[model samples]
Target: MKQGQHKQTDPDPAAHVSAGSLQGYKGLTPALLTKLAKLGISNMQGLLLHMPLRYVDETRITAVRDLRSGEQAQVQGEVVHVEVQYRPRKVLICRLNDQSGQLVLRFLHFYPSQLASLKEGKQIRALGEVRSGFFGWEMVHPQYRVVGDETEVATALTPVYPTTAGLSQAVIRKWIAWALSHADLSDTLPASVSQSLNLPSFAQSLACLHHPAPEADLASLESREHPAWQRLAFEELLAQQLSMRRHYARRKHQGAPALKPSKTLITALLKSLPFALTQAQQKVALEIGRDLEKPYPMQRLLQGDVGSGKTIVAAMAAMQAIEQGWQAAIMAPTEILAEQHYQKMQGWLAPLGIQVAWLAGSQGKKQRREMLAAIADGQAQLVIGTHALFQEQVVFQRLALAIVDEQHRFGVQQRLSLRQKGGQPHQLMMSATPIPRTLSMSYFADLDVSVIDELPPGRTPIVTRLISDARRDEVLERVQDACMQGRQAYWVCPLIEESEALQLQTVTDTYETLQQSFPHLKVGLVHGRMKPAEKQTVMAAFSAGETQLLVATTVIEVGVDVPNASLMVIEHAERMGLSQLHQLRGRVGRGAAKSSCILLYQDGKLSEMARARLKTIYESTDGFVIAQADLAQRGPGEFMGIRQSGVPMLKIADLERDHELLEAARELAERWLETEPVLVDKHLARWLGHAEELVKV
Candidate 1:
């Protein structure tokens, strides 16, 4: 995105020139508008923000004689010959000469207007990739225009934009050029603020980006290290921060019923637990307790490493609400994970006279009805399920607290729907995939965060070993040994397309393979495609030690807890992301016996990225360290774990690369929201456009 030079004569440095709407532009057709809408652009602000993916040096022309095969070049010459041929295929051909040499212009697809435009003796300028054809050194379908010798070339590099199916670079370029010339290219940040942050003026930045001088550093531009790029990145980051803070404030003002803890159920549950709460768990639970006691709504993200006692902290938070006679609901992303939570909640609370219900899509009609009735009547004090808990039929009687596990797996609307299930319920979002520090500060700025940095005292440390698939038989023997030693093992298949059927097939095939190798060992197979009852049966068997080995997909990545299961084998480890591999590795190392995770990667076929990821996971058992490496390896977008459908994502700024910019934006956003509300409005309006409301939501 770019703007032109601003005159000091303007009364306000933050003066905004509205470009109005792209609909008012006579050059763009209705059909083109529809296509642009698919790309999330519908007006001038969006057009101004449409950045170039790359640029071409079309400012000069190469001599016809100097043309080389496979080089993209622009050449000018007189059209001396022309003809249409129909031998193997109908084609139009033209020959041009510019004194030193001759060049052939080939067009396989042509119209009569093109033929008439390429008449002999007309000087033509053509640009495209040069390649060898039947005629030596030819350019097929080269863009050309009949010209006079006096015609001058472009002063700036031609911009190529990211476009959709029916859009053209030339058309987008034309619109952007018009926007640069006409749109209000004024600064949104105050001059004092930009100067303090060492950022460039908005107008200057836009001008440099849209029409860089011919001698500009293209590498700097392409890599987005140029000063102009930083300026735009800062603006976008600022808008997001402001939007988040405003949303946070808006929610704070919409007060909720404070779920003050009577400590009756909590004290009972704590006394009955087999283990005491870790210090970190107690600290975080206290933080959550303080937030829930406030009259305002609590939107907190509870982050902890895999198997770091987050489940108990969530249970502790739920008891606070339940003690006040209000219902509490916990939603997990998958049925397997949800069922585990249900079983645990049932085990912990059922004895304390607390009713817990399970809601899932695969439940039988009669069972689902009973669960629904219990939830609606407030008889079920603690409810846990997959996304089904947020469905229309399941209404909470007095829902005061909502806990979501693996929160990133849910969509924006799904999360929002769950929030709306109660009248401003306090929300607790739990994640095992740790958020990188900078990401938590910037993208997740709105939510209060509590981190359980300490693991429980008695958990065993996991040893990660990388082994090639070439030694598959050796790895199989290791699994057999572990299972035979009175310990359980997990053989996890790679997630194939994230489709339930495909994942089921993957685990089934793996199950069959292991069945032949270990016919004596009882192995259980579970996947997302199985009915809830069926999955529960298999998981129950594994938990009860009836099954010695379990072969499953990533469904076991989060909530399947068997302290006796100490060995984890992840197939195609090279194909998985670092955080995913880390989570999978965490499935083991829960018991006192020394645990080991074998990363079974294909031999001699690992890509550089995959190799780096495997190495990162193998080197560190610390979730935060692995998380930072994962962020660097995959970039913040993928590392965020939330899908694009959840929120408005960054367009220019990268959470890893531009963290300094983000930090500056974060500090400035908080200060300006109170001291300079006008500037914040202009900046958010320009950068956020139609996304202002979406980001707030």
Candidate 2:
């Protein structure tokens, strides 16, 4: 029979079984299945599809005498003795003896039920690492099987895979065996496409991967040009590219009504600022002003490093809407940040006689109701707050533009929800994390990018220092010295409390320690779990100088601007992602005061990736440079935990390695979708459908 058309002995798929299925297999319970499902594996096909990461070559058996001290080998011998060692650590020791020599199989922490199966005077085959013990040769924690009709199978090379907590390797193997026996293989990719791609038949690849006839087959799988991996990666990337292309094309062609700026009002507001706008700020602000005048609503991303004067650019955009007799809003990720922006805008824009309102969850019900009424009546020209802006109660007279702060913090759905408020609003997604141009093209291709690469003049570069935990006292003393001069300080901790799994400083614990050490200094604490109002109060205390030091979590990483704050101490700094560290460091260097950031890390051990990040931060103050290095060190997936950022996750395509392929796929999709528009061809529709599914992953 042809491989792809294999027929099952039983016509009923459910009635079929395999050689490995036991009438009552031990430990095959419903709980284990549920756990496996949580790991993204479900059903018989999933069991077989989860291929082994690697395979061990046990085809050649070695005698005990032939085993070297550091080699991994399979040895066969007759069981001479079996003993249970119950002293220091529970272990089951089995000794095997052949004509050549003696070998002991030690199983540490073995279950009592397993002892009955391993008996004395039984011939068995064992696979493990060979090591020298006091009694000579030994195999530690090895797999073994008693002499049986299928003993020859034990001598063959075995596949090893990554499994979850509750699933055992043996159980996974048995389930895969059942799938291989019962599953009716069907070819998904057409023969013409396979031939054009120089790919193997789907059935042959799957079967060869599961049960390779020879070691050469395994070697072929590892090659970069392997048909299975190449095809899978390409398909996954193409799907995502197609979705992005479609979205881009749709947005670019959509007609948007643009509003003209009110020069009188903008001039009045700019005159009230305590400081003059920088040249970089003026340029970006003017660019935004022009975009607002077009027939199409602006959908732009403002990319800038930390402290690169992006806040002013956002203000300029908001001013344009206000001048055109429309409302504008800025959405921050957190309440504290939202409140901070509200206070700043009130101080700057309120002087121009422009009405501004702050809407957040932490506000009193009466206050929120009043703000909503004001917005609906067109009394509020500018509004700033958290996600609460999208709630149905808050209506705008003319919501022309929406500015999202730290854009990555919210997902595409959340951002869309904001635009969907009233009619579609022009979006300006702003991010302080400077991503390289190449990576940004793949990740944010849906928006037009405007980068403010140059920093505002007179902004001092922060002095960075890497200090081991052993020098904690010196760092604390320096912080005290800085605070003595009326400079505010931020002590950032990795966690809120000590964890058994992690050895890092917690915010609450650090706050308590710092309070005790500096009794005279006022200290305020903030974290994610705190109520929004409470967080705002503490942040206000810090800003008002009621608190000289603020011990907080990374919640303050974005949108909390205190120009007078010049000192930053990050505990367990090496544990943070590069982008996170940069944001934390950015909390300082805002004011004219010479600022400094102390990265306090635990002494001794550090992973290579962590070391690279710490070194990069110390060597450069440029966020773009740091971002590029971070991307190279850790792929985009690991860089920011993209899932939490509301961004779609890529499965097989590496943003760093497959960037060129991603671009090509995007180009092809854009050209095809633009030219054909509807994907009328059946094959083309099928490809487009597959690509559409990838955009959401």
Best-performing candidate as measured by lDDT: 1
Candidate 2 — what's its lDDT?
0.75
Q: What TM-score would each prediction reach against the true structure?
A: 0.91, 0.81
Residues 1-697 of candidate 2: C-alpha lDDT, one tens digit per residue: 0012222222233555332222333334567667667655555445655667777776777889899998888888888889998888778899998779999999886765557756777787888899999789998888776665346644435667678875666666666666777665555445764576676665666666666654446675654335665555455455555566566656646565587876787777777676777777777777777777776657787888888888877987888888777889899988988888888888878778888899988889899889999999999988988999878777888888899998877766677777877476687888898878666776666567788878766778899999999999999999899889989999999898679888676788899999999998998999998998788789888888788899999999987888889999999998998889999999999888999999998877788878888999999988888999888887776664466544445654566666665666566556656564443232223333222433221
Whole-model lDDT for model 1 versus the true structure?
0.85
Give the C-alpha miss distance for residue 416 in model 1, angstroms. 1.5
For candidate 1, lDDT tens digit of each residue in 395-475?
A: 999999999898888777888898899988999998998888888987788899999998888888999999988898899
TM-score, predicted candidate 2 vs. hidden true structure: 0.81
